[model samples]
Target: MRDVAQPAVAAPAYVVGSGRNATLSPGEIGSFLKFDPDGSGGLKPRVDVPTAQAVVDKDLSSTEAEPKDATFSFAGDAATVVPAVTGRTIDYQKTFAGLLDALGKQGDPTPPTTFTPPPVPPGGTRADPPPATGRAVNAVYTTTPPKVTTEALQAIGPATVIGEFQTTGFAADSGQNIKRVADQVNGATVKPGDTFSLNDFTGPREAAQGYVEAGIIEDGVPDRGVGGGISQFSTTLYNATYFAGLDEVEHKEHSYYISRYPAGREATVFDGVIDLKFRNDGTTPILIRTLWTPSSIKVQILGQKRYDVTSQTGNRTNPVPAGVKSLAGNPKCKPSKGVDGFTITDTRVLKDVKTGQTTSEPRTVRYNPEPQITC
Candidate 1:
């Protein structure tokens, strides 16, 4: 009986530009491309090698002074002080909890957590393409990707041939002589936080970087004398890395495979453009120690044994042989004068040099016929 008044009317379901503009979907728009933490714009985080080494040394010294307390509750004195001990607790906690949870869920089932985020419209934050400088081209291209080769996995440190492969005919290390000095390094150990800049070590990719007008392989073709054989360092180091179990953050595949390298194992290098980089993520510090005892240069990796450094490669003989499936396209390539235009089926072998034993595994390096140029 008390005020049986009327109710207000309901609004329409669909209204165009009535209040907020209408869109097909109801979701907020943002960057369509996921931002890479390690991408160009992100902070370049680095740990200094010297600083890291100092920290480790200091830690070892302090730990030696501390007495070992085996009992979990022996004393509440230094539990909070030791970082190593602190981290160990975290590892154990996560592991045991996971194990117990798995055991508990043997028969029973639990509800899963679900999330429904609002939809995002197309084209939000646009990421600009990488710059188009020569170095930039190499930089972007090198980061494209790389395929591992079993042969490369077999050939690693100490056991590696470490040959110079002297490029003699064209001044060996010349710019005018055609052959040029593809690349050079003093073999200084790179510290943590240290960068491997090709331009810094080898100078510009010009005559100064040491090479002259000569027949150099480019895009699978010996187009003429330009930059020559410079890609070998990248390819060689890449092979060593495959066997070393080191991470390959970036690399570039050749337009066409090179016969000298395990087909999928090669990498390219261009001064100020493409550079090889890796981080020593082990808790113990590492050194990029080099030794030039003989004619060949050896790049050695030195670090404390954190985890069992493990490495693997595709079978040199191919885990899945080419005979399993025949390759298509023209098998032959046209050769140029004084240039042997021929295909070199990728053939490689891997060698592992751990403390006790050494093993060699073969791999295949294929070459699509590259037509060399003539004057």
Candidate 2:
């Protein structure tokens, strides 16, 4: 019989997405098929399920995204809801099954007729392989919804101003630091029974994070450091937490009293050392809203009004006189008049709105006299 010729067959290929976005292909996902000779003389296609699945997982990883919950954005005294984002993930099993089914429908190739071999010329090569061929099957995907949807947040309740406090009279540099920290803290939400930490939320206070050198108390003396004026924010937040009837998890009083802050109620923070933390003790989530101006900063807590809170500051006691300090030759020295140190107590009286019950929490703070400095 005369020699017979066999037509070239192409491997199957799969693709996801469409148009310009269609960079994903079957070869990228995994090598799913291998050809084996049938006893009758034709080639049989077999799919490696495990290998294909592994490749699918590795290839689709970049396509996966985490869902984001909805939250509120506060401007002035009004609040607006931010919509949640839906996430997407590929359905590996469905995609693989669909691809396999598509390939099966194309059917196996017919066996080539028997033929006599042809001799190749010396130093010559056989013809180049045929170009790759395959069918492009679309991938299946599933969407993930956010846990806290905008509708759910709105159904909770209206954001009532439960606590609010404002502080003023900071210099320009200190004011910048204060505003930077305030921006980071603005519109934070604390879920019920969850504690919010200033350090944990804002991370490190470095220049890279947008904090600048400003006035700060270093070792009971006036100095300048990055994020110096943020303590004013801490003091303001502490007062807001106190008036909101939230549980104070951790807070520390300033080493020396600043005239602008409430004597016994003020708080100070140092990164990695001192921190301002508070727990949302109520049933509903609380939103922290911060606002700042050129000379002032304000913090407000918005949530259910569970308690009517008030403060009573007692008289200062245990007076300690400030001593004089001379830093005549030091370029970094800052001069100031000394102030007497004393101990004082701030009592928070909480009255339950529903039960009409009342409770008192007393917090005492001691200040170390600020020494008079001479540069």
C-alpha RMSD values across all candidates: 24.9, 14.2
Model 2 clash count equals 1
* Per-residue alpha-carbon lDDT of candidate 2 for residues 1-375, written as tens digits (9 for 90 to 100): 011111111333443421111222435433555557788997655556676656655545665557666676768646667766666666666555655444433323432122222453422222211221244445455778776566545643777778999999998999988999898887677888899999999999899999899887765556878888888999999999899899999999888898999888888898899999999888888878888999899898988889999999999999999998888877778888889899999899999999999999998999999889887
Against the true structure, whose TM-score is highest? 2
Per-model TM-score on C-alpha atoms? 0.35, 0.65
Stretches of model 2 off by over 4 angstroms after superposition: 1-82, 85-152
Question: What is candidate 2's local distance difference test score?
Answer: 0.73
Which stretches of candidate 1 lie above 4 Å from their native place?
A: 1-184, 193-195, 199-201, 223-227, 284-298, 305-375
Q: Write the per-residue lDDT of candidate 1 for residues 1-375, one digit (tens) a residue.
A: 111101000110111111121111111101110123476665422223343223223322222122221111113211111111111011112212222122112221221222222442221111222222110110010111112221222222112222212211222332332212322442223344444544465566565555555456543333455455456544555554444434446666564544455555567766667766654342322323223321233344433322233333343332221121112342433344322222223223323333534344333343333333322
Score residue 289 of candidate 2 by CA lDDT. 80
Candidate 2 collision pairs: 13-134
Worst 10 residues of 2 by lDDT: 1-10
